[model samples]
Target: MRSSMTIVHAPQSDIKMIPSPILTQVESFQHWKNDIIRDIARYRAWLRDNVIYDQRVDKELQLIQARLRDKTLSIAFVGEFSRGKSELINALLFPQSEQRLLPSTLGRTTMCPTELIYEQCSEPYLKLLPIETRQEALPLKHLKQQEDRWLHIPLDINDSKELQNTLSHIGDTKKITVEEAELLGFDCQFLESSSDAHVYVPTWRHALINIDHPLLRQGIRILDTPGLNALGCEPDLTFNLLPDCQAIVFLLNVDSGVTATDMQIWRDHIGQLQDRSATNLFAILNKIDLLWDDFADDEEIKQSVKKMKTLTAQQLNLEESAIFTLSAKQGLHARIKGDEDLLKKSNIAQFETLMFESLIDKKEQSLRKNAIEKTIFLLGNTKATLQAQLKQLEADNRSVIAMLNQGHGEMKSIAQQAKRDQVVYQNQIIALKASKQAIAKQVNTLLLSVNQDHFSTYLETTRTNFKESWSSIGIRESIAHFFTCLESDFTHLEIETNTTIKIVWSIYDKVLANSKLTHNANDDNHPDNTDSNIDKNIDRNIDRNIDRNIGNTIDSNIDNDINNNWDSHSSEQEHDLDLVQPTEFRIFEFNHSLAGLKTKATQYQKSFRSLLSGQRKSTHHFFNSVAAEAQQIHQAAHVEAKAWADGLLIPLIQHATSRKLLLDQKVKVFKALAETNKSQRQKQQELVQFQASIQLQFEDINLMIQSVSQKRPQQSFYESLKLKSTPISSEPQVY
Candidate 1:
């Protein structure tokens, strides 16, 4: 039994007040306002028809609930060549493990993103997949075979030895051979020559290898990227890949400091990703051991540090305090030895602390809080809206019940008509169900017909085109001609050297004029009081001493009076010499210096000349190597293309065709059902009319009840019902 009553009360002064809950949470409502409006419209429609509306509501709620679940936080390590990204990961993970899988040398080591995860299961498995099967998994041993697309390596133990064994198979240090390139499905036409020799390719083209490690399984994904510069001007490796990193560590060699190339890399790659307020960037001064040795004095060491700090700051646009200096090798040693003192001294301890406590932890907390706050706000608004709608629906239902009570006399007559309308609606629902099933079947069939093999064929064709295009350009010959021209320009060093010396002599004459001086004596000829013969001897000695001291200083002590005059005169001469000597002597000194320079320059020219000749001989050999590699790649691409066409594309095509046929079948079924349900349309029309009529009656009944309630003052409905000896029968029942 249910009761429906309508009452009109006097408007309260606070009726205009907005709910505090809604006002307080205005920011939260912004994200869900559109969804909330849509939901309200849907509920109104559902009030007219319950079956369809309830189903949709349930589905929507499920999706919303799923979205509230915890999401994994992914942190990636990314940087240019040999920037120690992989070593950083190793330091974090296997503090004691000595085995290095990622290449630490000058060349590139990682070809693709390799993931390390820990598995609690007993047998450690390595999985490889074919390049064609990007989404599928395969086994490790398959990597050894030329025809095999991918490798899956499973390590049996948790130690460094086991990890090394697994890594060794993939980390082949030898230069890439023509056979290897061909085996890897590269086109041979792009190669310079058709020889069977080895060629070098950049290491970023292969698939990622996953190693089962305990630390990685704990939810850390380390990404090692190729050098900042790409090979052969390839766009994919350079401009396309590096922008997505969340945190960056820029490694600089302490010995070289930051070179022009490093700045170029920064401008081209790192600077582009910077947002000073938001991004966390670390400049690591690596290999700091080069700055000092055990025998280096304290002052020298301090000066070196100061110079390194100043230079790094200027080049990187960072404060001296921001840059961290560390030795990666020494850090690893400290971690293994469990020596905290050594680790602190090694400089990596500060970096480790920043990563673990400051950066990673802060990021995680901020992301989690943001997600939670957003979810709570959305959920709260949704709940409030639902409550308001429920209240309104209750009021509407009460009015309907009252109407039904008032129209009891007409209801029996309408029941027969309503039954017929119900049958019509049921028929329409059945027809719609049939149509939906047909559409689903068609979609499934269509999906099956879409073959993946066609994509592989397309890839192979593109690769072949690229190879032919490279070959047609004849880049090797162009490079050779450029080298030849450069060699010829530097061949006339001896002639240039002679011309430079002649210019030096002309400048020296002007310098010699100011250096000549005349000294005064007591007597015009003889100053000392002595015989002419004795005086002549003394004068000779003095003249000899003066000659020795000219344009130079004499170390021997003389009479104080004589020394004072000489010093004063020499002081005056020193000022004049200082003005002219540097400018004049430098020219002559440079001429002398140029002799050695010219010899070295001539030797360099000869060496380069020999190298040019050797390069000409090697040009053919290099081209042959390139050509062979390209040909091998072309052959492999051909085979792979065929396999892809057969294995993936053909099936997709068939599946698509089948799906289309199924869709056609579904369309036919829906058409037939619609025709069969034509009679049900009339019944549905009658049901709508009867519902409207009943609604009007309920409205009238509610008005009458309200009038009666207003007239009976000083007693509420519930109180009135309680006072009555017999029940007033205010509650109503309806189905």
Candidate 2:
């Protein structure tokens, strides 16, 4: 039976606050982040006085802003037992702490996974869950709420080793006689049926360490996962925790290379990156110091490492650039001692530089990109509105200047031209109106094809097919088959969307052709009465993919790990005498499998729906865009035609009237019209100035972004770690 645990809100009294390395330097990443925050603020201001947006646009902008406010980077490090996973973490983030943050030994010490975190301004502490809770199979998120279920251990940050000592228990496990293990819920059915057999069980199922390290203090939380066994037992680790991590590093031993066990981990965990970004996943060839050849010089060492990197890349079916090699032990030692030569030998500094360049820098780029895209889009709309406002001002201003100078004789000709222009505009409006009606009819027809019922029917068809194959094919085959179903449904949505886009453009072209501006009936000198109109504006579908491949790039980085989770504790435990008890293991396995099956259908439904939702949003957004494109052209034409007629005729009429009127009446009316035009010109000038200033800011932001993006590895760090030898084959050299 499990016992109740006590919980206390971690107090912030007397905590050692480490200043972040990032804050100490004004790096490119920090600079970009600050710029983005300022841009977002300016964006909000612009939106306030200018553009009107809907709920969806508002929600998206808010989310990007929230990411700015809460700048946390979470990374997960996963590997099998004895891969020096702990040492690599210690090397990367904990070298300055001067004490080992977690336990690492030649033996399998890290029994369960641990998440190292530091809530800003909170005192350092530890939360441990006892092994007894494994029976309940409750997720850690729920168990965390009970507070009492955890063993809270507060730390004395003043003592350097205090944290190290407390965290040593992460590696702690207890061995029990087979019979005793069976009594405590381990399965011992096939363990030689021996009374003397012993089984090892982790004393704690999970540990949460709250420590104030420099990186952690700066909003970076690292998840140090356990060996393959814990990944088997912990469902929450595979599902809830790992999926949320911004980046995941898979560590492998250089001596063993991609072993059978490593391959399994790759196929299950790392392979899931097909749905997520391949960029977010990294494979490290660790313990490279073990491969140092006695006779090998600098060149030879380079060749060997390069070959190994290439081979590793081939085995994993990843890009060679994605595979990096380093010796964690040497790296930690070098970092602690500040030995540059040893650091080169360890290849740690190069890896660190690349991480700073690739991961951390890319993270900043991603945030800025989100801000820039939305800002750019909204600003584009604001600029168009300002231009529209200005066009009206320009038309009115020109009319006043012309009216003041027009001769009485010219009035008759100008009036006759205005009348003819009005007729021409009327004809164009009729054509435009007819075109708009056709578009509305087509849009309605297209929208009918995308109703909720239609989508639901497609999903139901997929689910029905999934249900039929699920029992016969088992998990792997069933999953592959389900993706096929999704592909089919996705294709249906894509095809329908593509057809709609074609129909919309076809209607646009046909209607816009009907708008034949008659220059002969009106003023032939009108600026818009030329081939430029048709060539420029009528090509409505230029470069715009209506559904944009129906989010082809969107589906490339999917989150498909929801249901395809494979437990890592192999059935190799079935006969191993030195591991988990067999009889109880069988029961645990059955229970976990049964539980997984119950949730499988639900998880699959959620996953497919999420993918479908992305494509659906793309379709709708595309629909709106096409509609807006067509509308803008019609609106621009209407406004221009009116402005031309009003601009040309109003001034001539005013001049004719001024001649007839007495000086007093003419002066008052002339003054009022002149003041209105002057006021509008001032505002229009301000809008132009504002646009220029914002454009400069936008240019600076883009230049800075590109500088970081094009940031090539300088010869110093990159050359030190460059791989000289290439693998034998271009193809995946299966090991």
Model 1 TM? 0.38
Off by over 4 Å in 1: 1-83, 96-148, 158-162, 173-198, 202-204, 226-241, 267-269, 275-279, 292-322, 356-370, 382-735
* Cα RMSD for candidates in order: 43.1, 18.5
lDDT of 2: 0.49
Question: In candidate 1, how many Å is residue 200 off?
Answer: 2.1
Residues forming the 10-long window of minimal summed lDDT in candidate 1: 576-585
Per residue, candidate 2 scores C-alpha lDDT tens digits across 122-164 of 6788888887665452455668788899989988766646555
User: What tens digits encode model 1's per-residue C-alpha lDDT throughout 1-735?
Assistant: 111111112133432211112111222222233343344344334323422223333333344334322222233454455666666555555442334444444445543444444444535554433322211122222233443454556665445555554553332323467655444332333333334566544342333445554334433345454443322222122222332233456777766777775665565445544442223555676766565466767576656766776787777776554456777766555655555655566667555544333233334334333333323332332233233323433453344344444643232223222222222222222222222332233223322222234333433443344344333233333333333332222222223323322322221221122112211121233333233433354345445434433312212232332334434432443221122211111123223322322232223223222123332222232223222222333343333323222221111122222222322332333234324433344433433443454344334334332332221111233344442234232112100
Q: What is candidate 2's TM-score against the reference?
A: 0.57
Per-candidate total of colliding backbone pairs: 48, 15
How far residue 651's Cα lies from its native spot in candidate 2, in Å, is: 34
For residue 574, model 2's alpha carbon misses the true position, in angstroms, by: 75
Runs with alpha carbons beyond 4 Å of true place in candidate 2 = 1-27, 49-60, 130-149, 175-195, 233-236, 291-302, 361-371, 407-671, 674-735
